[model samples]
Target: MLLAVEGLTHRYGDKTALDQFTMHLNRREIVGLLGPNGSGKSTLLRVLSTLVKPQTGRVEICGFDAGKLPEAVRSRIGVVFQTPTLDPLLTVEENLLIFGSFFGISGRALHERVRHLMQQFGILDRRTDFAKTLSGGLRRRAEIARALLHEPQLLIFDEPTSGLDPAARDDFWKAIEELREKRSTAILISTHLFDEAERCDSLILLHRGLRVAEGTPAELKATIGGQIVELVAKKPEAALETLRAKFGAAIELSDGILRVEAKDAHQMIPSLVEALPGEVLSVGLHQPTLADVFRKVTA
Candidate 1:
């Protein structure tokens, strides 16, 4: 395992941040940490990056015990925090140089590494531009370039695309895919965006600081089974009872919406419309998606 965590738990006074969270990551894989706000994603990243110590747990990164040898673990991991860390006043190349120096890289070797990263990230032409003058997309690329200067075994990102526009987000993901292909670096990124999560090789879904589910996007969606039927009705609870009674369907009713799973939802929709009559305001049927799976698991 490139990374392994077991029985990881953390607390802030009376509130629990992580409850027996456990996960394993392999080399050359991108794993996404997924959850809503306050689900312990940030806390988990902090612990893994050695920024915050867990109250109880075992963590191993790149064959080194994270809890006992934090420095060794740190040396093997690169972290891009949720907030931008680049110095706005520094030029793009200068920023990379500063970050590289922190890893004891210097002289001709550091310059060569910096040039390689700049070229690889396609920011070589912008090397002399101040960080503040670059667009959001370019700055994000620079941040990633800086993080890779040390060539760490694992790279962790915390909502790295938080404020990026759609085009910028896509560009960032392209860079991520390139990293995987070129360096074979194991990646673990946290994000609330469902589309971003879908790009991951696998996902760990968290709820209230505990892992509720884990799988590839396809595997996770498959758990919902067949097709998903969503209905907006005047009386959701009543519609839920009717649907369950008539079709023996597994139903979920919340917030004026009723959802059920069926093998042939298209055939069943007509029957539903007939049975519900005027109660159903709208109906939709589709195959399960990551967003749907997340909703079901976290509900």
Candidate 2:
């Protein structure tokens, strides 16, 4: 394992931030940390990155203990925080070069790496522009470029697309996938976005500072009764009780949306329509998605 953690725990006075959290990461894969806000996803990342001390636990990377050899672990890792923090006074290339030099890359090697990252992220055109002048998306890209300058073996990101528009978020995710293809970097990230979590090879989901579930997106989704049937109707509230009473443990409605979890959606649709008492707007049948997994486990 490139990264390993066991029995991790942290607390903010009386509230526990992590409860016996244990996880591992392969040498070259992106693993997402998923949960709602305050689920301790970010807290887990901080422990892995050695930003905050865990009251108890052992963290190791490449056989080096994280608590005792934090410097060594940090040197081999690149972290992109959720918030953007590019130096306004420095040009994009200059900012990247500065961070690269921190890891001891300099001279000709430094320039080459900076150029490659700029081009790779589609920001070569603005290489000479100061970071403060760039838009939110471009600045976030520049932040990513800076983190990759040293070619760290493990890369960690925290909500890389939290506040971006749809187009920018798509572009950011593309950049991350491209990096994975190029370097096969071992990545760990904390994100609330369901789409982001679904893209990961595996996931650890936290709910209120505890590990509620852990698995690949598909695996987790499969545990939610196999199938998801979405029933759309003109009178969702009026029909909910009938569906619930009939289906019992198999159905629920929390937000004007009803989910019917059964072995076969096609077989259940006829019974569902009969129970509903309005013009059916539509019906969708599919296997459970990552969102469904989160909702079922967390709700």
Candidate models: Cα lDDT each:
0.88, 0.82
Scored against the true structure, residue 85 in model 1 reaches a CA lDDT of 81
Cα lDDT of model 2 by residue, 1-299, tens digit? 78888998889999988888888998768798877778887778787787876679888876788888889988988888887778899999889988888899999999999998888667899999998999888887788778888877888899776666776667667767776788777888888788878788999888887888988888888787668888877877767867778878677775777778877777989888887746568888987788888887678
Those runs of model 2 whose alpha carbons end farther than 4 Å from true positions after fitting are 162-184, 233-238, 279-281
List residue ranges in candidate 1 displaced over 4 A: 165-171, 233-249, 253-257, 279-281
**Per-model TM against the reference:** 0.87, 0.89
As a whole number from 0 to 100, the lDDT of residue 293 in candidate 1 is: 84
lDDT of 1 at 213: 97
Residue pairs in candidate 2 whose N, alpha carbon or C atoms collide under 3 angstroms:
none
Let me know the TM-score candidate 1 reaches against the reference structure.
0.87
- lDDT per residue, candidate 1, 1-299, as tens digits? 79999999999999999999899998889999989889899899999999887689888899998878999998889999977788999999999998899899999999999998888667899999999999877887788788888988899998888767776676678777877888888999998888888889999999999999999998999897789888899888888898889878577886777877777777778888888989989999899898888888888
Q: Native-vs-model 2 lDDT?
A: 0.82
* Native-structure RMSD, model 2: 2.5
